[model samples]
Target: MTDQLPDAIVAGPKGPALDLLHIVQINEEIKSVVAVAFKINIMALNAIFLAKRAGTAALGFGVLSNELRSFSSQLRETMLSLNALIHASVDGVSAMLQDSRYNDILERAVVLASKNKHLQEVIEQRENATDQFRSKLSGLRRALRSSVDDAYRLVELGGVLAKSAKIEAAYGAGFSSSLSQVSGEFDGIVEEIRTSLDTLRKSSFFRG
Candidate 1:
């Protein structure tokens, strides 16, 4: 979703509408997490190949690499869900802002035409629409919150897996150094994802 809201919506006569800049910030952080996930997958593949070259000695390391690959796939799916939630939220917030503007205009018209029966009907319709948008937005936010929590847990799992890979790397015989290097890379990438998600969770959209 675009960061810019309509000027009329942003500078509503009532006051500034909801700032959408936070949504943009949230998207950036999610993109970062997604990129890190991609890197994790690549690293996992490389580790797997290295483990194979180390023969039976690196059997445990090979198993950990496969788990890491699976974790990366799960993380990618979670990020996709998050991106969809963010888009839905942006649409909902935009609709709410537009509705607020219409209500403002309708209120002024009502004051000027107090005896106009049709104006009341229009105002009621707009109020109903606003309520619907609000309810939808609330649900989207809840889903977004849950998805972020899932992402956090997955990253924590990745961290544990990376540590396990490091331990297994020690048994890689002649390939121990190469396996260790790949495992270290896994640690770094997982940490990067963790940090990105931390920032995303702190964004205003995630807060109550």
Candidate 2:
């Protein structure tokens, strides 16, 4: 029979055992989310630097930039910690699966009723672990989705800030048009991030 499953498992069937490979794929997605946060943080820092260079005239914007950078930094750290947990879980699952020899047993034409008590216990243990990881990964996906939305808000706020700075610069304030340029750049980056997040959320991995 042809295996209908993809190279990566999105959401596994509601069973106790999961595909470690799929968990690894999920970790990759988590990393991607972290990377996006890092990029936003870098951009926010750049904005802050520009605001500081504008001196006393842009003090308010400078403060806002610092806040934005801080937010992004916090987000990145959270995602990184989550990703680490996932990696550890993956390793543990892989070890358990190997020790139980469930994959090998499952591949054989053995009858469930004829299985020994030890094998049954192992199977149950694997199933419980699988269910737990599934739940954890689901929560992580939700968190990542929320983070993406937060990033979009940041970019939107950034655009507004740029517009404000541009107006002030036009009024002969000691600010530079670089604010406007950064705003436009952020607009482009945010659009790309939105598209990517939309596609990611639509994937089978994100399915309930």
Candidate 3:
């Protein structure tokens, strides 16, 4: 992902590392993924029931369905964590912006009261606050990247499981067609989640 912020968010030494609106958009996207994951879990349970109805011929398919259900749960959990990280980052950015404004006002005050030692001390304190916020934002960015990577890996594993399910479906005898349809649904849902993640990774916050 590019380190460049989009035109909508101001980028500079004084501006925030990320904007609130952008963070809100990211949260909405993650929510969509969570919704999709929920659907996947339900579909997996249905597939498991169908496999059981098919008897021993669909044993492998049943196992894969169970695995898919577990995977969906994992994906949802990862997304919730990501959402929390984003919220924390937003809080940090807001604090930094407030500190920056205070610093700017203090610097102007220093110009008027150049001989005031107390005002200079306050300015120094504000500067320290800004630095602390920057450090926090940096740590949060790293965490967001790590979480995104974990999510990407999980989605990849889901894709593998979906393909395996499709293969196993072929051994379902009379239930092969039904099993195949469920596998296709799984693949499609996984692809949708992957697409959303790709978009999120391309956002400015994921930048180095």
Q: In terms of lDDT, which candidate is strongest?
A: 3
Question: What TM-score does each of the candidates earn?
Answer: 0.84, 0.56, 0.85
Question: Which segments of model 2 are wrong by more than 4 Å?
Answer: 1-22, 92-176, 190-203, 206-208
Show model 1 residue runs off by greater than 4 Å: 1-19, 110-117
What are the lDDT figures for the candidates, one per model?
0.85, 0.59, 0.88
Between candidates 1 and 2, the lDDT winner: 1
Q: Model 1, 1-208: lDDT tens per residue? A: 8898988677653321443566767888898888889888988998888888898999999999999999999999999989998898778777777887788888999999999999999888878878788778888878888889889998999999999999999988899999999999998889989998888777777553
Candidate 3 residue pairs that clash: none
Query: Tens-digit lDDT track for model 2 on 137-187?
Result: 566556655655564565455446444544544432555467666655555
Compose the digit string of candidate 3's lDDT tens values, residues 41-122. Answer: 9999999999999999999999999999999999999999998998998898778768777787888898999999999888
Better TM-score candidate (1, 2):
1
Q: Show model 3 residue runs off by greater than 4 Å.
A: 1-14, 108-116
